[model samples]
Target: MDPSFRVLLVCTGNICRSAFAERLGRAWVDETLGEGASRLQLSSAGTRAVVGSGMHPDTALVLAGYGADSGNFRARQLTADHLADADLVLTMTRAHRRDVLSLAPRGLGRTFTLREAGALLDFVDGGSERGEGDHAARARGLVAALAEARSRRPAAGDDDVPDPINQPLETHSEAGQLIVDALLPLLRRLAGAS
Candidate 1:
C-alpha cells in the first residue's frame, strides 16, 4: 500500500485562509482523484487559533461559492505533532512558515508558504500529468521536488495570503481567490494531473 501523504495548512487564526484552503484542497482532491483521494490527507491549524471556533462566516461564504463544505470545521492550534506528522506544511504566510518551523525544526524541508509552494511548482520537472506514481507517491515526490527547487530561488516578497477574518465579503473573496490561486496548482500536481 502507498503511504498516506499528509498536508498541513496554517494561518493566524485558522478561521480564514487556512480553513478555506483545507476545504478547497479536499474538494479538489475528491473531484480530481475520486477514490484515489484516500491516499492523501489534508488538515489545517493556526499559530494562535481561535480554538474550537467555526470557520469565519466570510470564509464559509467563499467556500460555498466554490461548492465546498464549510461545516464541521473547528479551528485548532498548531502543534509540534501536527508538524511532525505532515509530509508537507503549507502556511498562509512566511511568518506562519517560521512559526511551523519553530515548532518542528525538522519540518523545514517540508514547510513553505502556500504561495511559495505554488511558485516553486513551476520550477519542478516531471511528476505532473505524466508522472509515475500513485496519489501519495506523487504528493511525496512533489514535496521533494519542491524542496530541491526552493533553494534555487529567492523567497518572494509577496508570498503571504493576507488575513481576511474581520474584513468585508469582498476581501474574504479576494483572500479565498489568492488561496486557490496558489493551492490549485499544488493540488493538480499532487494528483499527478498538472
Candidate 2:
C-alpha cells in the first residue's frame, strides 16, 4: 500500500481561512472517502499564528454553517517540517505561497494558492476514468495534474481568499463561499462525483 498523501493548508492567522479549509476539507474527505479517508491527511498552519489560539469565532460560525466544525482546532506556527511532510501545500494568498517557498524552496513543485489550484482544474484531463473506490489514487493524479498545469500556465487575476477577520458576518460568509467555490470542485473530483 502507498503511504498516505499529506496536504498542508497555510494562511495568515490559522484561525480563519486555513482552519476553515482544514475542517471543511476533512469533512469532505470523510464523506467521500469513507473507509479510505485514512489515505489522505489534512492539516493547517499560519505564517503569523496566534499560537494556541482557537478558531476565530466568525470563522467557526461560517464553517458550522457548512456542516463542518473547528471546535478543537488550535493555531500553530508554520514550519519547514510541515512543508517537507506535505505532498501538497495550498496557501490562501500569493503572499502566503511566497512565505511557504521561502521556508522550503523545494516545495515549489507542489505548492499553489487555493484559488490557483481551483483555476488550474481546467488544465487537467477530464476524460480519465474515476477510481471511485480509490480516491487516493485519483487525488494523487489530480495533484500531479495540477502541478503540471501550474508549469504550463502563468497565474492570472487576483487569486486571494480575502481575510474576513474583524469583518461582518456577510464578509465571513463571502470568504467561506469563496473557499467552497474553489474547494468543492476539487473535492467532488476527488470523490469521482459528477
Candidate 3:
C-alpha cells in the first residue's frame, strides 16, 4: 500500500513530548486505520539528552488521561538511519525540525513541525468544510491548505510542544493535552485515507 507510511516524532528529549506524541500518534493510527495500521510505522526520538529512558511519569499520566497507552513507550535518540527510513518526520518545534534536517539533508521535503502540519490540516478543514467527500481529493485539499497557511505565515516558527521534563504535573498535563488535540485530526485524515 504505497510503500508503508513511516513517521518519526522528535523533540529535544525523548522522555516527554516526543514520547507522548509517538504513542498518541501510533494509537490514533491504529484505532483509525485498523488492520492497515500495520502499514504505518511510527517511532520517536530526542535531538539531545534522553537517549535511553522510559517515558516521563507525567507523560504517561497525561497520555492515560486521553485513553492512550504509554505503558510500552521508551526514550530513543535520533539517528541517521531513522531519518533515512521515515516518510514523514514531525518535530515538536522548528528547532527540532532544523536539527533533523541537518542530520538528514534528504528529508527536508518530508520533515515538518507537528504544529505546522496540524495548522495545514486546520486551514483545509476550516476553509472548505468539505466533509470528507473523496479521500484523495481531501488529502490534496489538506496539502494545499497547509501550503496556503504556510505561505501566509512565513515567519511562523516552531510551535513545538513545550518540554515538561521536571516541570510541574500541570505542565505535563497541559503539554499532553496540546499534543493529543493536534494529533487527533491528523490521525483522522490518515485513517480516513486507509
Candidate 4:
C-alpha cells in the first residue's frame, strides 16, 4: 500500500495560474503514472478565489495549445484542509507560498513556489526512472531533498506567476506561457520521464 501523494497548487485567484497549474500538473501525473494518477493526486486553490469562476479565456487557450482541456474548471479558495491533505503545496508566488504557510505552519517543509520546487529538482540525485517503486521513492525523496536544499540556499528575488485576471488577453497568454515554461522541467521530473 503506497502513500497517495497529494499536490496542491496555490495562487491569488484560482481562475488563471492555479487552474493552469492543475491542468498541466494532472497531465504530467498522467504521463508519469498513466492509470496510476490516483497515486499522485493534483489539485489547485486560491488565496482569494472568486469561488466559482471559470478559467480565464486565455488560460483556456493556452491549455488547449498544450492539448489539455479546461472544460468546466472552477475556482476554489485555499483552506487549511487543502494544506493538511497535501504532501506538496506549489504556489504561484512567494506571497501565495507565504499565505499558505501562514495558514498551516506545519506545511512549511512541503510548500514551495513552482519554480523553486522544480529548480531544486535539478540538484537531487538518484531520482532516475528505475521502476515504479523507485520513482515513487524518488518522488518522495525529492520533496524532502528540496526542503534540505531550501535550507542551504539563499532566497532570491520574487518569482511570481504573473496574475492574468483583469489584464489583456496578451498578458494572459504571456502569463500562461510563463507558467508552462516554469513548470515544464519540474513536471518532467515529476513525470519520472527525465
Question: Can you list the residue pairs that collide in candidate 2?
Answer: none
How do the residues 1-194 of candidate 4 rate in per-residue lDDT, one tens digit apiece? Answer: 45566679899879899999898777767876778677677899999998999988888888888888897889999999989888789999898988998999988888899878766765666444333454456566667777878766657675777788788878877777877776776666655522
Q: Lowest summed-lDDT stretch of 10 residues in model 1? A: 126-135
lDDT of 3 by residue, 1-194 (tens): 24466678899888888899888888777777777776666789899847668888888888888778887666878999988877667888888999998999877656778877776675555443244654434444444456556655556555778878879999999888777777777767655554
- TM-scores, in order shown? 0.92, 0.89, 0.82, 0.87
Worst 10 residues of 4 by lDDT: 126-135
Most TM-score-accurate candidate: 1
What is the C-alpha local distance difference test score of each model?
A: 0.86, 0.85, 0.75, 0.79
RMSD in Å for model 1: 2.1
Global lDDT for candidate 3? Answer: 0.75
- Per-residue alpha-carbon lDDT of model 2 for 68-97, expressed as tens digits? 988699999999999988878999999999
**Of candidates 3 and 2, the better by TM-score:** 2
TM match of model 4 to true structure: 0.87
If both were scored by lDDT, which would come out higher, candidate 1 or candidate 3? 1
List the candidate numbers ranked by TM-score, top first.
1, 2, 4, 3
Worst 10 residues of 3 by lDDT: 134-143
lDDT agreement of model 1 with the native: 0.86
lDDT of model 1, residue 28: 84
lDDT of 1 by residue, 2-115 (tens): 467788999999989999999989998888878778776799999999999999988898899999998799999999988888888999988888889888988878899999
List where candidate 4 sits over 4 angstroms from the true fold. 128-137
Error of 4 at 179 (Å): 1.8
Best by lDDT: 1
